[model samples]
Target: MAAFLEAVPARIRTLGAYQPGKSIRQAEQESGVSCIKLASNENPYGPSPLAVAAMQRELAGVNFYPDQDSLDLRAALATYAGVQPEQVLPTAGSSDLILLLLRLLLGPGSNAVGGDLSFFLYRIMTKSVGGTLKQVPMVNHAYDLDAIAAAIDHNTRVVLLANPNNPTGTLFTADEFERFLDKVPARVVVALDEAYSDYAEEFAVRRNVVWSRAFDYVRQGRNVLVLRTFSKAHGLAAVRCGWGAGPAELIGMLAKLRTLFSVSSVAQAAALAALGDLEHIHKSAIANAEGEAALSHALAEAGYPGVPTWGNFIFVETGEPALEVAAKLEKQGVIVRPMKAWGAPTAIRVSIGTSAQNELFLTAFRKVMPAH
Candidate 1:
């Protein structure tokens, strides 16, 4: 090992980097075919038109530094989320806020608790700070809230959870979350990641499932942080803007530790614009619901029934090695996420795309997936 490598912390040396889904360009290059990527759970409809105009308008200001506090964007998010502006902290993305929280609360002797197979970032961020992440085993592909609460101990500094969780698209009800929150110690901060909250909320209304009450907790002065992002339904993934709302004091502390100008001027402007475009978000949700239903029905007919999903993705068992299945689909110009890293070698998580993209995926899937 190099001398510099020897000096590096063991946690830093052993940490595994996050593996993102394959991009369209990468897939096209490897397969020699044009591809539609459904692996990343991005909005196929693209960013809000208002957001595009905002970004274009903000282009001339790139030469200047962004507002260090992101005051305007935070105020917009506060209005949208029904929180006070002082209680909101804007970051580059929700992932960045996750890191900031861990750095503030976790240390060598501390730990965080989260469900196994939840968002991969909770584990990565906790470990990155030399803190342990107790991944309580999930039940039926959903978060086992009771098990997660039981896993928390005196040294546990944070609890990480994602509503309509990534990879699985499973969510707990508002009532369930309330009960779980009651069990958590006041000393431990709960970071409720609502990255897919918009989709989940729409699904909740149609399916009669209760959506998360994270913001409610924040309003009630609970020791919790609600994290949301513009990367998903808003289609601002490229710009990378997100925020965390919690107690005013906690938000103030995180704001102090936040990197200067972390959110670019363009990103801030785009997110602000996206926040006002309720029509685009609603349209995206309606399309996602329809695509999810169509894909689920089609997959079930083709012998691949998937878990009921609240987010814009479905977790389906392929009954074969997932990586092999994913590779085969890639060759047919479709891309999806294999769940091997999350421990289900026979499952793949497919993001709901636009009608045309979804059809393209189904065609490729039918060709690659053997008939039962």
Candidate 2:
């Protein structure tokens, strides 16, 4: 073990592995019962029929290598995002793009700024490249944009942000984001993770939250990278496809650093098909909005009110040890994510599931949680 440690970089040795949420099979194995998984913020409804068909058609061509540049898919995505094809870079997923950005921009002396409780990957990715992650404390369970801007300095290479931030599911508006960007130096690249942007847009009409202008920033020649994924509303998580839009020059740099043929043929095909299926996307978003409302209301009535979420998940303060609550719910055939890893020991993040799944979770929660 000492030899192995010596072989690895000191920075790499200090990092811990990412802990993903519990799977349905794992939950069932632990609980000895069938379980509904609401731990990962996946779309309850599955992928579009068109996307599935596209994957099926590409199966025979798996013997051949995928397009190295992902040209066709990039064109489709560019059109969808209202940007030039050169401005977009597709990858295996948004996480892949994050690593690529860090590899390209970070080094020993540089650092990245982000909310303390935002996406966990920001810290891991930064540290992996021997860079510091300056985490600014959040305000009211949301990103403190001003504090984050203040944290940036000469050595700051990146500013990482997640819309509908993970764990908390809170966001800042477009005006706020623009003001924050004004304070950022031109050399610092702002990597905006918009994995949950679709859901945020769906809820925006009712909630009055202005969606981000990251893409607009790209068009205006800002050093901003807008990362998005098909894993959520598109229901293409298994396909592992996502894209980043930025200035053409920045996109070129990321493309050069991207692993060769990182996105498989199956993933590219499914993502291409999913891009055109706006109806399915819209339906999924509407269903998620409905589910969020229902679940939030139910939890509130049960004396565990959840934070207003723009993502397809609700962050609830359980007023109990979150891991204990999660374990009890798992035993009752419901699986949720405890926020202990994110430093909120009394909170759990519950993905908004189908109405029936939500009902099952509520029933299980009632059985496990003591009444107020």
Candidate 3:
């Protein structure tokens, strides 16, 4: 009989599964106390009221399949991006888009490039396609675009760039990107995953340049695709819908690869409705900004300085081992993410929660860290 481990591909067996943040249910079950979870960078404020109503309305047609091509959502996303619907492609989420793009762009002999301390799913997705993953190390805990561009070779098919990058939450500037774009060839695809773009702060100094305009490069016919999710600012994480905005030709090819009716009717309906409630998103941003500032300040006062963040999560260096700190905190009714899988055993990622949640987390963190 064939052994189960032997049946799996070498790369698949070698790759670690994606480690999600600890669930609140799991924590409460393990601990005697009710837990406040600040692990997953989820919106502590729930989904838009309009989106909830839309989702409830969709329950009436639960038996019907979603539009295979997500036409309505595409049109909505296109309007937001100032592009044609043909240039937009919706997926189950940004992760789904990443998975689909990995399949479409990679094969046995190609390579994908991204940062070492980035959304690690890109590495797994690239490896699953039998492609080499070139993880360029960050400079000063931020993306070194120059190093990333220099890492690309002839066989490099895709470059995964996360704006306001995950874990570390560092964002590259428009001028920095413009310079980097000059080095990249038009043939190679650059995927800009902007899932955390909702939490990005607008600097009046820049006057309008906040999020990465990688999608605009796509509109200009560059080989770029900007990925966004309803999961973040729209607070529709459970709905599981995201999109890729790119050149029409690439989007057309990607559409051929999209799973038919993979997006649920509820997700589609909710995402469409979420787009209209711009004020909810603004409120979310304000709350997130306040939470992040408070948490960072608190962590600094405890002598555990955090990385400079543009996203809602704060990655702080724990004086002790990260997993150990997290375990202790979990027992004390607070939950944060341990970053051992990302190769940083000294860091714990704490998401910006609601005002009360943040206070609870801070209280628990101080209580546990001192005693641990």
- In TM-score terms, candidate 3 sits at 0.95
Error at 129, model 2, angstroms: 1.0
C-alpha lDDT score of every prediction, in listed order: 0.91, 0.91, 0.85
Off-target runs (Cα >4 Å) in candidate 1 are: none
| lDDT, ranked from best to worst | 2, 1, 3
How many pairs in model 3 have backbone atoms within 3 A of each other, for residues 3 or more apart or on separate chains, i.e. clashes? 0
Alpha-carbon RMSD, candidate 1? 1.0
Clashing pairs in 3: none
Candidate 3: C-alpha lDDT? 0.85
Residue-level error in angstroms, candidate 1, position 340: 1.1
TM-score of each: 0.98, 0.98, 0.95
Q: Give the runs in model 3 whose Cα sits over 4 Å from its true position.
A: 1-7, 201-209
lDDT of candidate 2 over 1-372, digit per residue (tens): 777578888889778887788999988999999999999899889998899999999999999999999999999998888899999999999999999999999989999999888777788899999899999998889999988998999999999999879979998889988998999999999999999988999999777767787788988989899999999999998889999999899889989998899999999999999988989999999999999989999999998889989999999989899999999999999999998887789889999999999999999998999886
